[model samples]
Target: MHELSIVMSIIDIAETHARNASSSAIEEVELDIGELSGVEMASFDFAWQQATKQTLLEGARRQVNRIPGKAVCLDCSASFPIRQLYDPCPVCGNHLLDIVSGKELRVRSLIVV
Candidate 1:
């Protein structure tokens, strides 16, 4: 799964930063995963468990902040929450939209020790 690759990338990023900062271990890691980021939570968790072994993040406390999808209808200028990218606007039932958030997939912060 691609989630495994994502976890590996996260580990690589944390290790690189921790090493650059002269830290021996990572104490905590915070991630912002949006609803429309296309990552399944169960799969991501499983991948994390398998990928972190013997790595710098093995003992790190991970905190994931799930962000909900939100968008604005372009045709009706209505704001609403969206669960999918193609979700029509609730007010106008229009397909055109401007995504406001929920496309994020990034590491927010890390506590290195």
Candidate 2:
């Protein structure tokens, strides 16, 4: 699945950074996954385990920090949390909310030793 490729990419990036620091091995890979990022957390975790099976990150732990989706209303300047992509602003009840957060999937940090 696509998660395999995504996990593979993550491993590659982490490996590069870990090597740069001269770390013996990567202990953990931390990720910030926004709620609206369209990534299934459990699937990603499973894919990560499968993808890193023979790589340097084989036993590396993955820590996911889930970020809630948020939006700012352009009409009322109100901010609200969104559960889905098409969710309207809770305060203004408007669809003109500008997305301020979420829709992101990236590595935030790592622990190496």
Candidate 3:
């Protein structure tokens, strides 16, 4: 699954940073996986459990912030919260929207030691 690859990438990044800082282990990791980011948290958690074995991120504290989806309607300039990518604007009922957030998938921070 793609989640496995994603977890591997995260481990790689964390390890690289740790090594760059002259550290051998990561203590914590913070991530922002938005609602519209298309990552399945269940699958990601499972992959993380398997992928972090013997790695720098093993036993690292992981904090995930679930960001809510938000968009601005192009037709009426109304901003609204969305649950899905195809959600139409509630105020103007317009399909055209400029997504302001909730598409993020990134490692926000890492604590290495």
| Candidate 3, residue 74: lDDT | 94
lDDT of 2 by residue, 1-113 (tens): 67777888898899899989999788888898888888887888789768898776889887888889899888899988888878877776888878888988898898999
Q: Give candidate 2 regions above 4 Å deviation.
A: none
Q: Pick the candidate with the highest TM-score.
A: 3
Models ranked on TM-score: 3, 1, 2
- How would you encode candidate 3's per-residue C-alpha lDDT over 1-113 as one tens digit per residue? 79899899898888888898999788899999999988999999999999999999999999999999999999999999999888999987889999999998899999887
Task: Give the clash count for each candidate.
Answer: 0, 0, 0
TM-score against native, each model = 0.96, 0.90, 0.96
Candidate 2 accuracy as lDDT:
0.85
Structural RMSD, model 1: 0.8
Give Cα-based local distance difference scores for all models: 0.92, 0.85, 0.92
Candidate 2: residue 33 Cα off by (Å): 0.7
Over 2-101, each residue of candidate 1 has an lDDT whose tens digit, in order, gives 8888899899899998999999999999999999988999999999998999998997899999999999888999999999888999987999999988
Instruction: Judging by lDDT, tell me the better candidate of 2 and 3.
Output: 3
Error of 2 at 55 (Å): 1.4
